[model samples]
Target: MCRWLVYAGSAIRPEELLYKVDHSLIDQSMHSKLGATTLNGDGFGMGWYDGPRPPGLFRGIGPAWGDRNLRELSEHLESPLFFAHIRASTGSPVQESNCHPFRYRDWLWMHNGEIHGFHQIKRELVLAIEPELFPHLEGSTDSELMFYLALSYGLRDDPIAGVARMVGHVERVAAAHDIRDPMQMTIATSDGEHVWVFRYSTQHQSRSLFYSRRIEALRELYPDNANFRRLSEQTRIIVSEPLGDLPGAWHEVPESACGLVDPGRDFLQDFHPEPV
Candidate 1:
């Protein structure tokens, strides 16, 4: 449904992740090799944090590959954590508010899949959101709705458990409507500190997802590679696909798994379908 990239590590300009690579996220906006669509030109957005709270975000209803403003902004904005998403609107309108990398308080989120039967299931899902949070929803997107659903289920404290519970609710409700496999999601969320990513679908086959190997290991593997040399040891990235063709540099996240990049730990764990 979309193409996205998440970067967390040493402070650096966003272009290093969004545009510099041979097959960067911006490139994917025009020629995505692994997404449902090769050209995700509906819209694009970027979010970055350099403070105590969540990051600042810039979004527009323009294709990522040809946006002069995005190119200009990425060159100057630097942060230790950031997210970029190129959209291929499955149901939502291609408007600024409907762009990916939605935000709330000190948190940012983006998704690369759809809520099947969203139009039919939208009411039930919306009614489940916390009233306070519901009022804050600025867009009519299944992705943004999913974010608030996680928040209502306690995302601010325990993202993993909260998201699982939210998914559980979706499954239960969708079943009532005779909707099978109601979800396909590759989501990334962060609070300017710890970042969590999930890859799951009700049918057990989800979209593509990968995370980069540690920068140190990459440096050793390609000692003469300037790209790997410029990165910090903790530099990490999770994407809808490998950013480049560097062999052994990326690993596919298992289906029904969650990847976490905390301040000190970077690892993934199998995700069970049951409510957590």
Candidate 2:
């Protein structure tokens, strides 16, 4: 239902992907090729790690394509690891607080897709969040609630398992309410260093997710491409959709999969939801 991207590796201006690319995130906000909706103009957000400070965040309740501040900030803000999301509300109100790339302490998170019948199941899921975390729930979107649910299940300690538990917990509640196939998500979260991504849903048809091929390999394919010149061999991007159609440059993540992208190495593995 939305478009987003995460970058890890060498520090670079976000505009390179948000505005400069052929089908950039900004472009996708209005002309999404893979998302369920064509217009992701409800709101937008950006989160990035800069130095030792907590990650910087900027969110706005406006079309990303026309946001003057988003455009201006993207041009100057450079980060080794960053996340950008443009939203198309499933049912949540269009508000700044509902925009993605949600932050908690040093962590940042964003999501695409929704929990079917979220309104019917919201109260139950919200009640399950850790009492302390419940106060930090700043938005009404299912995505933010999912973030806290994962944290309640232990995201700060074990991100993958925490999210798995969160998903499992949600499905359990949904089943009680007679809402079948309640989960659909492609999520990305980071803690100023490593980034973790997941693609999964109860119905087995998750949304699009792709990662950039190794910069070393990309260089071999496009020696004259200046974009690859500065990126480190480990530089990786996990996106809702491809930034361009460069052959061998993008690889679709398998269904029900989870992966990690760090400064060292990146890998993907099968993912499944288990009982909490």
TM-score of each: 0.97, 0.98
- Local distance difference test scores for all models: 0.90, 0.93
Regions more than 4 Å wrong, model 1 = none
Off by over 4 Å in 2: none
Q: TM-score of model 2 relative to the true fold?
A: 0.98
Put down candidate 1 lDDT per residue, 1-276, tens digits, no spaces.
899989988888999878888898988989999999999999999999998865798999989888999999999978889999999999678899999899998999999999999899899899999998988899999999999999999899999888998898888888999998999999999988889999999999999999998888998899999877877888889999998789999999999999789766777898765553
Best candidate, lDDT: 2
Cand. 1 Cα-lDDT: 0.90
TM-score, prediction 1: 0.97
Instruction: Compose the digit string of candidate 2's lDDT tens values, residues 1-276.
Output: 899999988899999999998899988988899999999999999999989989999999989999899989999978898999999999889998999999999999999999999999899899989998888999899999999999999999999999999999999999999999999999999998889999999999999999999999999999999989988888999999999779899999999999988766677999988797
